[model samples]
Target: MADRLQGKVAVVTGAGNGIGEGCARLFAAEGAHVIGIDRAGADECCDLLDEGATGALFQRIGDRHGRIDILVNAAAFAVFDWTETLSYADWKATLSGELDIVFLATRAAWPWLKASGSASIINFASANARHALEGSPALAHCAGKGGVMAMTRQLAMEGAPHNIRANSIAPGFIKTQATARHLAADPAFAAQVLRKNMLQRLGEPDDIGWCAVWLASDEARYVTGADIPVDAGATAW
Candidate 1:
């Protein structure tokens, strides 16, 4: 049996860990040539927040790959604090990181995606973008993700004429490397999160990866401008 994404080239940001890593690995496994990008040292457990660095990564991919069949923008930043105590710089940093990276990656990959004949752009949003999770102090982070959804819809409409589809995935509390440290320190918190889910468990990277694969594949050829949630029914509650 041939792979679903054979002969395709995919660019996945935040590919160093968590959901992005899962998407990259799964895309590769499904026969897509994956260009994995993250902030420097992310491949070796370092933070990736440099705009120039991310731009350079995508530029290299465009130069080498010539075409990007799927572009997954999964890079984001958030600081959990109450709105009152959140500093201006912290708020700006979180929103800027997500907005800038998503914009840069999409712009850099535009030509290649256009050339691919049929391209898919997958932007990452959060469940909080719709239903706010209590205690999340970073209101700007929530707002930025909402921006991502709007952007996704607009881009999907704009890209449609070119046979390009833009969509977003709103993930709810998945177990990612970044969140693991916090969850580990507070098992009770983690347990509470799990109990909120209809599945009675938190999500894993593969859960998001599978949704990404479908969205990027021909199977979802007609799907665009939609925010698909892989929240394990967290949104249902």
Candidate 2:
């Protein structure tokens, strides 16, 4: 299990925190040269929403590294509001964050990924992409993640010829800084989530991180155009 990704070059977005950070750490531990990208507090700080900046940054990375063996699009922001109360601006922002960011990052890394001849792209979908979260206003998040899942399949098809594999990880009720805040604000939410979860506990960043490691590793070479749910069976119901 150690050094499963030896000598690989990995770029992980949103690496300053949450699932991204977890994956970055694990990738590095597995002997990949990990580049952590985020708005701040990462190896590379840049606004992923800025198309030009994102392209330029990835170009630099590709040129310097010669190839990108792994690309993890784990950064995104979404607003949770009832559909009736959700503004167009917020809806658009959610799509941009959750859906658009993935596109920009992948597009920027495409050439280098092709160069690798066996690159893997790991995207973050969500349990919300498949099922409702009951009380939470996840309309925008759901749509955005659904787009990611679909886009991943298309990317897999496009990347197949280049030996690049594309896959997604769908998580549920993972405890990150954002979810921690929500759990703090609404203590009952934890109980509600656990009640629906087969594991009866909240997930940690590593819960999703390990799965990404597998997807990024050569062990998953045959796996592509797929979505692996790490939702502790929450989505099973």
The window of 10 residues in a row where model 2 has the poorest summed lDDT is 192-201
Q: Estimate, for each residue in 165-218, the C-alpha lDDT of model 2 and write its tens digit.
A: 999999998999988888898888999898889987789999999999999998
lDDT of 2: 0.95
Off by over 4 Å in 1: 41-56
Report the CA-based lDDT of candidate 1 relative to the real structure.
0.83
Taken over the whole model, the C-alpha lDDT of each candidate is: 0.83, 0.95
Residue pairs in collision within model 1: 39-48, 41-46, 81-137
Clashes of each: 3, 0
* TM-score (C-alpha) between model 2 and the true structure: 0.99
Task: List candidate 2 stretches off by more than 4 Å.
Answer: none
